[model samples]
Target: MTKIGKLYGVGVGPGDPELLTMKAMRILREAHRVVAPVSSDSAEGRAESIVRRAIPDVTIERVLISMSPQPVQGRDSAPTGGTSADQGGGTDGYHSKDSGYERAARAITTWLEAGEDVAFVTLGDPHIYSTFTSIAAAVIRMLPVVEIETVEGIMAFQSLAARTSTTVCDAEESLTLVTAIRDTSALERHLTDGTTAIVVYKGGSRLPEIASLLRDTGRSKGAVAGELIGLAGERVTSLDNDEELPSSYLSTVLIPSRSMTKTVEAGEGPA
Candidate 1:
């Protein structure tokens, strides 16, 4: 009965390999096991993608917790094709009624119970809109004895700003990042509120709605689209008009909090 080393939930950042911090790389390369989340049993895993891009040759064991088709299809299965097979080979989809967080906790507890250290990698900073928080919460309640550590990484919003030469905020300003779907109804409130900047975390399908909202509120000039920032397919499209955003999930829109005021103060053209 050996005591297991701690579990490290490492943030791999948006999608760029260079964004990986040295400490995160060091922990990932040395971890005994790595866990990632998957949307479907058939979809590619984001955490694993980060690991492969950072340290392709590491030979640690891999675990995956599928996020959809609730009632977690497989909890005990062997890793196959760089992924895990379901309880019945591949027929049953891997998901859980308890959501991805619970399934991940079960997997991690199994490793911890066996005296094994594990690392769960996530995209972007764990504290910043990452799913690692849900997994962390579950682990704390169910496997209280297991030690947990977190390693932060560059945030997607920061990376996106860097790639586009857009200033997220100055020392005199502040910012708020929210998921697209979660904050739709607050559109009017946020516009009137003094939150320096609003970073719509996922603006794919919401792109049109967002564009419409901005136009209707007369804030279209402050809106811009950033997709796959820091990755190979990165695209930064500025929308001075409301009809040009391409459909994309990795997309985000930035609306300066006092866009009109800023324009007036600087005597600059709108957006």
Candidate 2:
């Protein structure tokens, strides 16, 4: 019997190639071939871009996974006009026979069955709002005995916090991470919940609305927004100055908790 190769889902961190972890780099170097998801055959995806910068000589296999969610009959589909990162993770609770995940999984399975370890690279943490989750799940369903592992990577919120010199949260303060691709009702609720710091992702298009909600809830005092952090066109600005916020698909907004806001106001810095 031939030995099946292990599958590794690696996170390449946010845009910066230098942010790639040592373990992730080692796995990419040792893997039979790295698989990177792309919106189309010709387009280079963000994850692949980071990998190429870090390991220029590594072999990469491109997988076409549409950035937009496909409409499923008789089921409520995600709202349109958001990037793949904005679409959230997983198969959205359902999978189709001819779905992108199915095709990607089949292609990967062939390599795994051939005794070749494959590394599927993703941006940020593979478990956090990453397409790798969907692809890995599909592969597991097909090959039940295959070993799957994940490598952690720095999240955008963490990078944005460092760029803006703002502390994400302190002791006893809850942090809520959410995507603003849909409505603002959930975001509004988080704003009003005392001691909760909210990090909103894919909120570039809804900056104005988010700003208004922050103000209405008094969470806009130290709010900050970052776009393309650690990469080209990087911009980090105060949400108080909405005009300065970059309206890009890679935008991330961090609204500090009331306690942290008080700490900054008092010039004590983060505790």
Candidate 3:
């Protein structure tokens, strides 16, 4: 019997090639062809760079995906005078209506159908807000029996903690991971609700508002504000009171829980 081709979705980690997990690196080097999403300008693929640095010998295939989310019109949707097209087209001014992953799914499935082992490389972990989820969903829907594998890479949160020398959370404390860029109110609630640590994943576009909000909350408790942790370029400042915050895609804000106060006050540091 012929062996069924398998698809491996590998996370390459944030920028650093050495951060790749052993399993991810192994699959990238062993896979028949590696795939990465590219920009409309056809510039070098971001995720591809990380993988190439780790396994430079692997053959790579570029799969272009639109970074924009699809705009859906619901029955109860407010009547905007303009359609999605009026919003200046999709990312890179490409007016193509099809979601990028839809195209990516078909491309991946075609490779699998050809009996080739394909590896889809993603920055950070494949499951953590990566576009691989949609592409994988498409593959499974078309070929239910398609073999799939996922290899975890270092998440931005962990990387941020390492860069800032900050503890994400101890065994005795809880960590709440949130993507609060889209929801300011939710983020405010978490900051004040006494979460052991608040790790915000996507804070690029909403940095200004999030910073201001955090600054106010930290002022009452004399907590530092606007801390952007991760990588050598990390900007870990008190956003609650800082005048400026450095920019980065791998940014994460850590709000340590009150339980850590005793240890901190004792000059004992993180648990």
Top candidate on lDDT is 2
Report the C-alpha lDDT of model 2 over 77-102, residue by residue, as the tens digit. Answer: 66433565322334343334465778
TM-score of model 3 relative to the true fold?
A: 0.80
All predictions: root-mean-square deviation over Cα? 7.4, 2.3, 5.7
Tens-place lDDT per residue, model 3, 1-271, is 4565799988877666789888887888788878887755365565776777777777788877655433355323322221121111122222234556678788888878888899988777787777676678778987898999999877766766565456656676777777643456666767776646676655555566777776566522222323323233545555545457644444556556665544554677765
- Superior by TM-score: candidate 2 or candidate 3: 2
Candidate lDDT values, in order: 0.64, 0.81, 0.63
Better lDDT candidate (2, 3): 2
Ranked candidates (TM-score, high to low): 2, 3, 1
lDDT tens digits by residue: candidate 1, 1-271: 7786678878888788878999998888777777676655565565566667778896544445554333334445522212121111112233344645676677887877787778877777777656677677777788787788999977767776666556556555667666553336655557555446778765565677778777777666556778766666777776556456755556667776564436634867434
Model 2 bad stretches (over 4 Å): 73-80, 85-97
Task: Give the C-alpha lDDT of model 1.
Answer: 0.64
**How high is the lDDT of residue 244 in model 1?**
69
Q: Estimate each model's TM-score.
A: 0.78, 0.92, 0.80
Which 10-residue window in model 2 sums to the lowest lDDT? 85-94
